[model samples]
Target chain A: MKKIKQIFYLGIKGSNSFLAASLSAGNKVKLSGLASFEEIFRSVEKESSAAGILPLENSLSGSIYEIYDLLTDSKTFITAETEVRINHALMQKERTGLQKIRYCLSHPEVFRQCRRFFSDNPSIETVPVADTASAAKMLKELGPDTACVANPAAAAVNNLRIKKEHLEDNRNNYSRFITVGRKLKQHGNKISLMFNLKHVPGSLYKALSPYARLGLNLTKIESRPIPGRLWEYLFYVDFELNNGKHGFDEIITAMKMLTKNLKVLGRYDKYDKIKNS
Target chain B: MKKIKQIFYLGIKGSNSFLAASLSAGNKVKLSGLASFEEIFRSVEKESSAAGILPLENSLSGSIYEIYDLLTDSKTFITAETEVRINHALMQKERTGLQKIRYCLSHPEVFRQCRRFFSDNPSIETVPVADTASAAKMLKELGPDTACVANPAAAAVNNLRIKKEHLEDNRNNYSRFITVGRKLKQHGNKISLMFNLKHVPGSLYKALSPYARLGLNLTKIESRPIPGRLWEYLFYVDFELNNGKHGFDEIITAMKMLTKNLKVLGRYDKYDKIKNS
Candidate 1:
């Protein structure tokens, strides 16, 4: 067996991150949880046997800004990616009728997802908790009337009774999870690059010119704000290599001239850059 | 005065959104609250005399993703921008010591800001609420032991007493707010443009080149993900016009060839894009 491959994720077990990590890890893998995303990245960069699964973006919620910030700050690379279908259910201490539950407890994102459910039951008061796991604990402590929106794992772990299943407004809700590693794995054709551009005029346009000149197809382009520096943004771009090989070197050389600092984040095959898009 | 200039904001009275709107609006402005961000956008676009102030980016938290998504989906343009200093305090029903508080309640963002306070007092169990305004309302209902992280306005409006002030770790926390309207107000040197490019290689690079040749400085470049169409992104850029006057016509003509669809979002001055950044 491969000496127990180590995998890290945000939050403890029964979390969405944990669920994704479990689904993505190989045989004999030891899954562990980190308190913060920063810890996960730190461990992944230090240990070659380790990898981390982080929620990059949710289909409904857009991108997780903190994850991108941590990724840029670390020496890690995106090795793989996966999607976790977010399934939120209303759980309580016992089988209570919808009318009996006065308060609903869950994360704010969970509340956003169950917008329709809350709207339909105007009498039910919605209270945002930290996360699903915490919501479960709070349900036990905060009295019987406080219901929680949870995933299957959270409900099972906490031994809470499910009052209703499929509470989320949309059935197709998903969060795109990306696996990070210390070593750049040559597992796919898509390459990710991040760079800081000069504040001068035409710098951004000049920086992107090389990729356009080489006829490279960009799969993604994202910009994250720097904390203290408000005007300048760090650009992250993911593009499929020219025919899965040539023209990468040329593009890098061209980027070096335009950008103050640039880092090749990773190169991997994107499982499905989304089917319809 | 000035026909009671209408300004729309997110959330009801005694909320952070309301606070930002109040600070950003001009004299004789009649501010109104909207139930949802979508409603604010719809009202702003349909009414010629109306404008809505939406939170764009926070210095510490980064971009507000939902606002960006809504901005792209609507015909409204960003007409003005401003920054509001975020101040959070510890409030409760009584002037009880921190030791008396068993449960700390507030928005998750508020909790994040008071990380130091929480770590120092590990016994305080944090319960995240919808927002500061709701947290204040909950303090009246959820018992006196629950202390809330709140703004001064929320405390005053909800009749909650302040226990501790300046609970936020960073004194430099500020949120960038933008006023959106139907008309593209051309009051500043900066111009905002958004475009959806074809999936073909080099399309984005080609689209940005005209500005580079003309030496127009790009102040901002943000990309928002399109739901269902996961891979495709809408690029929003703010570039300073060449010498604050020329080359805009030439760049627009070139962009027409490369982009599938393009919208000129607006042109207005950014009130201090952040001094240090």
Candidate 2:
């Protein structure tokens, strides 16, 4: 068996460090430093790392555009995928009560999840940190008076006491992460493409007509702003098509006539939740 | 004219508050407490407020969904509108040095705008507060050691010093605010509506077909997730059909058959820099 190379994880704060540690499991895949999308991309481009994991979307906050834009702009291809179920907890140092937490540190999303907790305690000021793991790090450094709202893994990793567990508003809160590398290898059975339609009425409907006519089932479609254009949008679409040669060619031909700018990001199987499931 | 009552302003942390204050002009309308969509909705519904001014969209951040959702859900009517050129600034107390500042507080959107500024100073943490005005309030309470990144009005309102200004990633920053009340007495030329088409192909095409047929030009269309539903969306549309009587019923009838759900929020004349254009 070929040896697995070093993997670097790039994400926008939160519990990415904990997730990376879990993904590594008992393997010898040494986890590199946790960095931002721009930093990780630079590292990958300069051959400083072999593979990197990035958060594609969150259940509550929707898409992380920075990573998406970086993914599209880079020559990397998604190699593997995983979903991390986030169980948010309010953590502080040992022997501290909830009322003693004068300052709360967390990401915007975590702050949003525990809105009720914060609302009930209006006197406690909430501070927005860049990442959940970093919040834990800071909480450990700041000691008992400062509590951090982060995942249990974050609390455990930083040796902080979990004051309150399962603080997320929704029970099934999850974030999907994708591994991107310099090579192209399809493991899953799905094709993802992104495109932009003209800023006119029925433009999106017209663009998707051929697919609907051919009985192609679209799995997901998300629209994000096209920078520089005040209100224009670009749609990212994922769909399931046959993996064989004939079925693939026909879809490409249909896509060609649908929009002016078409980018076939990759074709891979749906990233299933096998490990945690 | 009748004595104007209190005006409820839905301040967007920084720029919108200044624009709203300026638009109130010499009228008897006094700026009530600055509030967000939820706060404004609850305030106006219970109080005797005359008008509510809230932001609809910004050039960089797209639409403020909390305001839009409030507009659609509440009993507010469109009365007037205004626009403001946004200029974000990094602010602190007069004598505080940039290096001395340990924490920076602002709205999440403003924090995003000045991400580059924070990138340069990795040691200083960026914190997201309720709004720009609130951030300024915290800065005043926390003293000079904690700086705030906000608008000039926010700085003046909270008595904070502007350490640095115009800290946006993009130069052409602008935000549009709308005035809504329970009465349609004030005139406007634009109509805004929201609806949902069946998830099939060409549904949106057929739904928008009548607007083109009636020669009524459509201005804007935006989509937001239908709360508590997966794989479904409701689209918000702004259009030009100010005639009030002609072709309104027919256009709505055509759209009903082509869509699963349709809701007309309100209608008004084109936003005149001050009143209806």
Candidate 3:
């Protein structure tokens, strides 16, 4: 019998990261949990896990910047990518009237997504916890007067009763997750890279022009402050090209010449959007 | 006697926004407090306040993206700008040893800046509140066992003892603020604008080229999702040119042709960085 690879994620059972990890690895892998993104990265680096899964960005709230900062300094490569449609559910230990619930607990990011719900229930005191699943667990321990906003899967895992479904203000909210490991998977058409360009007029335009000239599709571009350097930015870009293209090497060579520092993070398949069954 | 203009900001008496508002409006203006950015905008729109002050970006943590999104949707023009040096301090009601402090209260953004302090005292429980000044007020009510991370000015306002000064990991942290009002302030050299380009391979590069061609210094660029449009972005840009220069009208006309939707948010003077008085 073959040993199953252990996959690590940030949060307890049934959190979004856990669901993303399961989707990325399938049934052959065993899922484990860690307390923080730092811990998950350390576990993967130490060979205790096959890959670490993390949410990279959310459609409504924007990018998970800490993960972006971590990617800049870490040697890990993105192995896979997936998207999870976020469906926040309000859960409690027992069935109680909405007016009776006095406290709400969840991760701060989840709170931002449920602004409408919070505004409607202004009397409910909100408390931030480490993660959504942990909030569900805490709600279970706190009993009837307390509730939490998390996923339905988390409510099921914690044996809590769902009081409200689709609690997010925007039903279109989706989180994009990426799996990181020691080696590149190298099978996908989409490529992600980070680079620092000289601060000058048209420097970014020059650095990005080669892709445009090559007729490549630029999907996303983001800039973060280079650490210890005020006002200087490191740009992260995602672009797509056919893997069998002939001039890919020449393009890479040209990009290197245009940038002061550049690193190819990974090439990975774009996850197909999973529609509701 | 000249009627005093009212300025609104987020948080209580001694928050960073309060200080920024004071610095931007000068002594002749009366300062008012609001609970959130939405309220500030509403007050400005309703003509209850002469202007609204908001933090646009931080050097260490990147953009205050919510403000960026608000600016994109708002008709209010940026009339003035200033930079405030951030100096976070840990405060308590009494002189208590660091080992005795059990709870830490602060705004979530402040917590991110004080990661080193949190890691050093891992046992301290962190609680998120609406603003740093409110956190200081809460800490005072909670007595000596609790400490809050806020500016030294907040500590002075709330009558809390500063247990530790300069708690932020990076001393270079500074927040740039912009004042929004009904009319543009035309005395300054810097101009801010927001626009949307048709999404394509080189759309952003094309949109940004005019500034480079005219030798205008591009100071900042950010993108936020156009409301109700998935994956489409509205770009915010800041550029500087000599206020007395010729061809300004021609540059504006050319830029208008390049973008689908364009609006000049404001033109404002660059704030001189005050280095510890």
Candidate 2 structure quality by residue, lDDT tens digits, A27-143: 766666654566666666556346677777655445555666777888876666667777778888775766777898887656766667788888778887666777788776685
Per-residue CA lDDT of candidate 3, range B145-212, in tens? 88998887778778889888888876767777888886666567788887886656678777777876
TM-score of chain A of each: 0.82, 0.80, 0.87
lDDT winner between candidates 1 and 2: 1
Candidate-wise lDDT, in order = 0.76, 0.66, 0.76
True-vs-predicted CA distance for residue A141, candidate 1, Å: 7.7
| Per-prediction share of native contacts kept | 0.59, 0.08, 0.21
TM-score-superior candidate, 1 or 2: 1
Question: What's each prediction's clash count?
Answer: 3, 14, 0
**Residue B208, model 1: Cα distance from true site in angstroms:** 0.3
lDDT of 3 at A84: 79
Which structure is stronger by TM-score: 2 or 3? 3
Worst 10 residues of 1 chain A by lDDT: A268-277
DockQ per candidate, 2 decimals: 0.52, 0.23, 0.37
Root-mean-square deviation of every model:
3.9, 5.2, 3.6
lDDT of 2 by residue, B87-196 (tens): 78888876577799888887766766676878888878887665676677677678667888777777777677788878876665666677676654433557677787
Q: Order the candidate numbers by TM-score, best to worst.
A: 3, 1, 2
- Candidate 3 recovers a fraction of native contacts equal to 0.21
